[model samples]
Target chain A: MLLDKFQSMAGVRAELEAIGIVPFGAVTEKITSATEGVVNGHQVILAGTNNYLGMSFDTRCIASAQAAAETWGTGTTGSRMANGTFAEHIALEQELAQFYGVDQAIVFTTGYAATQGMCATLAGPGDVILLDADSHASIYAGAQLSGAEIIRFKHSDTNDLEKRLRRLGDRTGNTLIVVEGIYSMLGDVAPLKEIAELKRRYGGYLLVDEAHSMGVLGEHGRGAAEAAGVEDDVDFIAGTFSKSLGATGGFCVSRHALLEAIRFSVRSYIFTASATPGVIASVRTALKIITAEPQRRERLWENAQLLYTGLKQLGLAVGPSVSPVVAVTIEDRVEALQSWQKLLEAGVYVNLVVPPASPSEKSMLRCSVSAAHSPEQIDHIIAAFAAVNAARPVGIPVA
Target chain B: MPNYNIYVDYIYTVLRTIKQDVEFTENTDLVTELGLSSLQVMELIEHIEDHFDISISLNILPDINTVGDLARKLQELNG
Candidate 1:
């Protein structure tokens, strides 16, 4: 059955490769120089990554990781549901809870696991999971596993949302409306306060995932919910340290005591080992930097604005992004592939997205600006996009 | 109870923001008049679920041809 499934999807890998995405995590994984990624021995800029904060190389984080690795050895060797809870793990969870200003926090080995696990635990059968159509695959997977009837809301349209709710009546009691603080693809934000207002009036919980927005948005880096002034109104906050934190783990923090119960019941939580010592240490250090050094976030935004304004000025179809994630939406898939190659040839690397990752028949050349980037680097990024824009009048549609 | 009034209000907001022009009471084809692609229609339904705090099945999604048709469907769900 496994081989049959493989055979059925045999075209997927080759198909993706033909489009330039290639077996991304699989390829280019060979040991290369740290400062630049070598793809076929060509040094390429990594604009596709969600590393908005660039704390992956923070010396203090590295030191903390090394220190934790030396102290705790390697892996936890057990799940948090069992003997996996080390003092460091407990301390990290406590610190994260305090950081988010929530009563309890549970750490998962990956952000994907956290989103799926917490969604599954929080929503149930006969309940509703209203999601954004543009939500990440992790959110969709969580909603699917949660046994709730999945409902999709138009991306950022609060009015279409109210109509869908009126259609549900008393069933609203069991609903969990899911949204993200900053959407990974187009880098757009949800209308959180309005969503929260509906959730409050209609009797449901709001679960906001700040996976991409953590350390990148809001005053204290609390994310889009804080930006919208709906922090306390959100029932659960889910995020991962992978993107901005440059670590590998996920977390769910909530004011509900019920969240603590999910720790015992969720299989994904029960069976999986907790985050490694190094990861926890790095995240702890990363969180401190995210809060203490607001300059990183500011610089990241400045870079984003530079790139965005530059591309627009030079006549490119850049997205209406409010964050560091700027998307260049193209209409045709093959054309997107060609544009990706062009940008690469121009010395910048970006994410090449096609449907169903892209919405509304849209393909995107996704570029993420980072705090690690220099202004010259930002200008180079702009120049690269400008070159691509000038060279091609592609078949991208205006919606 | 002005349930139709609520439907018109919702439609007004959607049209103003997403579409731009539409008559409330006449035959208003959801896809054509609202200019909603299939993907956007799906998103619209999801937004309705969140807005009303209720669950709607993708299966029950109506071929919304007129403003009255959408209003009637909303009444059925609200019932």
Candidate 2:
């Protein structure tokens, strides 16, 4: 009798799950031999994960994780500030600072925590926090929590940003500019140099979240800020170890020592339990491998360029994406879901981004490529898309 | 930009950003005509807030439906 809200949720859940785009709790590793799933009793290629560098199964990282887990047991069991602080965490922070060529680096339990914590701590009641309209939800939540007058500029529109900044005038005292290094859905990168210059002029702190671009972009795998040659121009560079590094954790690095002040102020860091030793060990190994293995970055770019070129040659709309994450836009949500189901059925898995996730009218198929995928596997994926996309929708296809 | 309806253009951009229909008229309801969910409509408010640099009251937004309605409100706020 009192199940109306739950019933509505159940309906939405049923619709989503029926289409193969299983939400969190319902995710069936239908192909579990490799990453845990039981899909028709056989292992399936996992292409949807944000595993850009494919370092998850690397020998060194695995070995390091094993060692740390064995040595430190299971969990940290406390926050970083109190009983949770470990030598490994400090070492990782130092390594991340050196890696980013920044003077300061503060680690957090998650990339989301890093973004939210830093933004929330830095911005104040009267301050303006302007961000790209397409920024991640974490950034939005952080802005909300910061009590800052949040502003949104058109995605990647420098002139629009200038207009917003101009309006703020001398009130720019505590203005904080935030943008993502690589957008999650579209995979398009931000114009960091243009934005950094704007920040420089406006006299505000600039923060770049490299959650999607951590090891995917930049020659040194530093991120968009480094790639855009604005590493120095940017005031803060926050990143996740989840993507290219193939681990779980986040860090915020900066040229100014003031960013360290946020450690005492940010609640997300002080409240949550610290990251496990295993993640730190593996992330360190992965970061080293990321910097040393230029070949991985090259191969990743090769795979991305191949897929993008191949998709474009097929005469389908593939991106606004300039990175390894390629998105094919579909105007209809049902059509998008159908395409995703077909891809899963064919053993080529990708992320299904509908309505709320997409910052545009079209739902998107977000395919993330990695260095681990061979030329043949890459070709097979493209061929599959070609066949699948061509067969469906005689009048209109998802792409 | 010539002969273009700036109001409709702006509305289309905002609606498309939130994955709603681009169709709108003077009497169309912002929530009903476009079928905007509560979340998306809030996002629309955020878009308007940034574009205009003026915070809108919750009550004033509920009566808005079409691009004309929103544009007129924006003009009033600016004035």
Q: List each model's interface RMSD.
A: 3.7, 5.5
lDDT of 2 by residue, B1-79 (tens): 1122554566668877766546556566777667777557767876766655654433455457666787777666555
Model 1 per-residue lDDT at B37: 69
Q: What is model 2's native contact fraction?
A: 0.00
Candidate 1, A1-399: lDDT as tens digits: 657758635677778776555524423433222223654334666777788888777889999999999999888899887888888888888999999888799888999999988887777788888887678888887777777787877677788677667766787888888889888888888889899998878777888999988888799998999888989899999999998898899999998888888788776788899899998998998888888999988988988888888876766677775568888888777677777877777767788887766876778888888888888877888888777666765433433
Candidate 2, residue A239: CA error in Å? 0.8
Go through the candidates in order and give each one's DockQ. 0.28, 0.14
- Can you write out model 2's per-residue Cα lDDT over A154-269, one digit (the tens) per residue? 78999878877887789776789899999988788899888888888888888999999888878898889889998888888888888888888888998898877878888999
Against the true structure, whose lDDT is highest? 2
After superposition, candidate 2 runs with Cα above 4 Å error = A1-7, A16-42, A393-399, B1-29, B32-34, B37-79
* Per-residue lDDT value at B71 in model 2: 71
